[model samples]
Target: MACAQAYAADTFVIKDIRVDGLQRTEPGTVFTYLPFRVGDQYTPELGAAAIRALFATGLFKNVSIRTTGNVITVVIEERPVIANVDFVGTKEFSKKDLVTSLKQVGLGDAQPYNQALIERAEQELKQQYLAKGYYAAQVTTTVTPLERNRVDVTFNVQEGGIAKIRALRIVGNHAFSESTLLDQFSLSTPGWLTWYTKADQYSRAKLNADLESLRSYYQDRGYLDFRIDSTQVALSPDKSSISITINVHEGAKYVVSGYELEGNYLGLDNEFRALVKLKPGDTYSAKALNDSVKAMVEKFGVYGYAFARVQPAPQIDRKTHEVSFSIQADPGRRIYVRHIDIGGNTRTSDKVIRREFRQFEDAWYDADRIKLSRDRVDRLGFFQNVQMGTQEVPGTSDEVDLDMQVKEKPTGLLGLGVGFSSANSVSFNASVSQDNIFGSGNNVSLSLDTSHYYRTIALSSTNPYFTQDGISRTLNVYYRTIRPYTSQGNNYKIVTPGVNVQFGVPFTEIDRVFFGAGFEEYSLNLAPGAPASYISYVNEFGETAHGFPLSVGWQRDSRNSALVPTDGRYQRANMDYSPFGSLRYVRATYQYQQFFPLSRFTDVAFNGEVGWAHGLNGRPLPVFKYLYAGGIGTVRGFQQSSLGPHDAQGNALGGAKMLVGDFEYQFPFPGTGVDKSIRMSTFLDSGYVWGENEPLHLADMRAAVGIGVAWISPIGPLKFSIAHPIRTRPGDQTQTFQFTVGTAF
Candidate 1:
């Protein structure tokens, strides 16, 4: 009894707790988890509990509790601050990726260093590897303590070669040939070049993916009840090679008899019935029914009923071998917006985002306004993603709040690139630009471009709201020297300085009109081999011309998102005429772009443009003012400015009138995890150019179809295309391919 009392007496009231090596964590953040307070009695049990809790925070290296007389001290050795994290042998994800993922699991800078975190991270990585079919992947993590109580972490990973689909066997597919059934799987036989292709060593992930592929394949072909029963992946003794076997069940398919509309439509029954597109004799497609319901919901939303709900009920008749769908609509009470919340903007100011909002506080919630707001934010091009949703404000029955989230992208960028084509020669361009411009709504860019035919240096700036009345202004100054490829000796240089100011006049919640004009002083020097047509225009417009290029333009863009548009039409029309000013020409151009979403990751775009530049009041069109085509933005199979008139030596003579038509089928790159960062497109471009007196000929027009890659690079969108001429004429130079930079369509 005496010994027990002595042991109990050794433990006393706690004095204080001290934390060391804390670089990112606050002391108060740690104190909340301690088991004993300053005046509370301390015991071995309590000390152990406190240590466990501290470790659970994942922030400490060592935790100890000691007592002296009636006072107790809780001493903690904080885990080293994560000074830096680095990864090697990783092309699968960017550095930002691991940082964000680790932060979510509480293992970032200033976070506790419990061994459990490291273990969890390792396991998670291995799981990801497994998902990628790296069955034998090995991952190891190491923490190296550095000076200043910080630490550097390295994830030593042996990702191993990706497992491929060596051999696939369909065990339960007796009705079909084994080979035929296996061919339906995306995972295929190991080619002789599997070292590079690596399509064959099977793993669980590949097997699962192939299972889904198989189900879809059969389902689309009338196998309504098709399913993958089970799959087995067997590995070789060395664990390097694998084989897979799948069991599937195929069942009878059904067709739709028709669709019926039920429930109240609030006097919109006929309107809602037309929204249902499913018809008799059509296959029983769940997807079709779902789409019909969603379309109806959107239709209701357009009426200011933002909280509409839609549900579809499908009825099956076994005897008749038919299916019928009944779509139900519920348009809830219309509510007004109380507030708008902006989130996920770590660097940009809220005003910058809010300025793009079309929906206002205390206004009836308009679904169109919400969509327009999202589109406007996306068009800013400052974020990789823009998402907006409504959050029902609790305790309020008549109003809801809006929350907009954005993922900021790098604003400052530097890049150097070079390209060569028959028309442009070897073109090298480099630049430095910042769109955000030091957190203000401004832009600054400097570019130095060199081509075999021309050399240019340009500086430009734009102030979004130069006069506070939303009057945006842009200033551009550039100097360029052109070396003509013409045999004639008329090569010259040009220097241009221009400024434009545009004002926005708001008309409606989602409508704005702007009118602007600019004056540019252009100094032109004639190049050699010039045609009579060209010399005549230049002689009339002359050496150094200063003109007020007056113009009025209007644009209306309605889309869900800008980078990856789901649905919208962008229309712009402008007319610029030199009336009583510098040069002698009148130019009018109009363009329309329509975006249709074929799927979540695919967009079909239709673009058309018409431009006419005619001499004003008997004055000839300026030579420099003529339109040039055949490049990234025009015909893809021809060189830059090569589509227009050409002299005997092939020097291009610009034209006064032009028309362009483009159709692009854009789809996301397979296996590229990023949805907006990259896109692959197949396009058809057709256009022609004609002089004022020259007659347009269909035989002289150009058309091409090809594939290209589009990347939303940090600098800007970079487009590279390789095309093949679809229609070739005899004696014509079949320009079969072309590559270019910037957004072409």
Candidate 2:
């Protein structure tokens, strides 16, 4: 029906068929598309039909049919195959990516060449650059013929300058200033931070998001009738710059005049009523109302109503600027989970994650258990993301399936580097830590230090599933040799080696108890000019001593995050007692930490720790086990382990009691957006260490106030602080600036 040329011929008895002018297409392919057979009759109508059939295949550029005697002949020119597809002047996108885009449109290497497809590709390329703010971009395509019916396609592009926002303006604001309203926008005009923030770039997605932010700002501040009337993004004729204008209608503000419940809350009206957060006289806030409704739904979900329907019915009184609302609820039929499906955990075993889940298949849906399950899995820190969902079983109203998905991340570290902690003068070290060994949920670590002042080796292992009931077991072995007092001709050294075993039992989701026992020995060899403090210790307790110590601890952590907590409380208490052996003493320590979320982008944290040790069985606490403080983890601006009493040689003498307190206020760093990983904070730190015979005095504590920056960088967590000591006595070692960087090998 779509013949390009007419066929004029007379009917004849056919004897054979022939095809000509095909370089790559076989003769049989042409026969398959022909309307007439070798022995069939050939007429003018039949010849036209044959021509149309062959042309529809798209394999040929030209098709014609002729009849001679009883034989029919077809002549065709096969379309050229695309030999290559390339681009020039395309600096905005990679060539491989562009090729992929072209392939989706049937225009790529080895594809049939068509002028229509080539035009489409050129337009598509221009559209892509437009989306990236390149309004002046241009694209042109060319087709080059080659021997053997082949062709090469080329796209030439000119990616112009990215249009930037020159100005942004907000209109129709009567109650709030323009500057105040813009605080909620993610989009901004060009500024000093343009290079990193790219705030000047104009994209439809960014503009939409900024408009939503502006709308939420008004809604949260009691403007219930607020609406965005119009928005205009204007581009300059030259296409080098753009400008945005927003017009908002902030209607009358409303207050919560009254509210009531109208729906069946499953006879739990008392529980549902307590969840209402709005007061009659308070200004209406969209966020608070949404949260209250969400809480009510979750409460219903706890009773197996997975498909509960909750709606807010509001009554508006325009004259009085007041709003009244009622929550309408419909409790769907109780549903049971038909299956518990886990996915996206390729490296970790199914059992390792399933054991931590509280929700199970064929059980009544419980929101609390599901939430706890998700939190526990998230707290493992083995995944980058975890998500949960429920899907109703097809044809089953009362059955649903629980879906848990996770995104796995590296839970081990292996590195070789020449890095050191800020407190150390010179250092090189190697360490390996695997928190999820072989994806079995066990942990092990080994660290070796060969610094100039000391040499050390330590190994630790933990089995979190030691008893299958969540009881954990840990073992640690360490050996260290200290040569701080060594010189060119005289060498004084202290050798110590120890091993410990510990077990942990969880009493609740947020609390745990630990108990352990260990054996430790100390051997010190004194030189002729040994420090007086070391000589005194050797004279008092001899050169060799060992102890078998028992330890007990209680820990509770309710933080929402382990690495960068915004709000929560954490506490830990530990005590070690040595009732017998040459070295006998009791040491105890307690730490309490609290984080308060001030706003979405700011927080406050407070930390307090105290420790005390005393000798038992008429023996002094060993100098090695004494409590020490005054460092980055303790009171900043002071030397590490240098806050205790000092001897005539100005050497720090370990103390029996220690106290440290730290307070910090964290906020967003400029040009970083809302990323909590990088933050700036100002802090106050104070601590002190008292000797065994010295009396506790608050006046003796050293305090410092400083500012710092914390970033979870590519390699690890890094902190740099500049602190100034405010209280110090004679012989106090102070440091004005300090930083800490981890080393790995």
The local distance difference test score of each candidate is 0.70, 0.83
TM-score of 2: 0.88
**Least lDDT summed over 10 consecutive residues: which range in candidate 1?**
1-10
For model 2, which pairs clash? 13-70, 14-70, 415-745
Clashes counted in candidate 2 amount to 3
Q: How far is candidate 2 from the true structure (C-alpha RMSD, Å)?
A: 3.8
lDDT of 2: 0.83
lDDT of 1 by residue, 63-162 (tens): 6655556655556666667777677766556768877777766677666455677788778777777666677778888789988687778887777766
lDDT of 1: 0.70
**Model 2 lDDT per residue over 609-703, tens place:** 99999989777778777888876689888766678787666556669999999999989777797888789899999999999999999988999
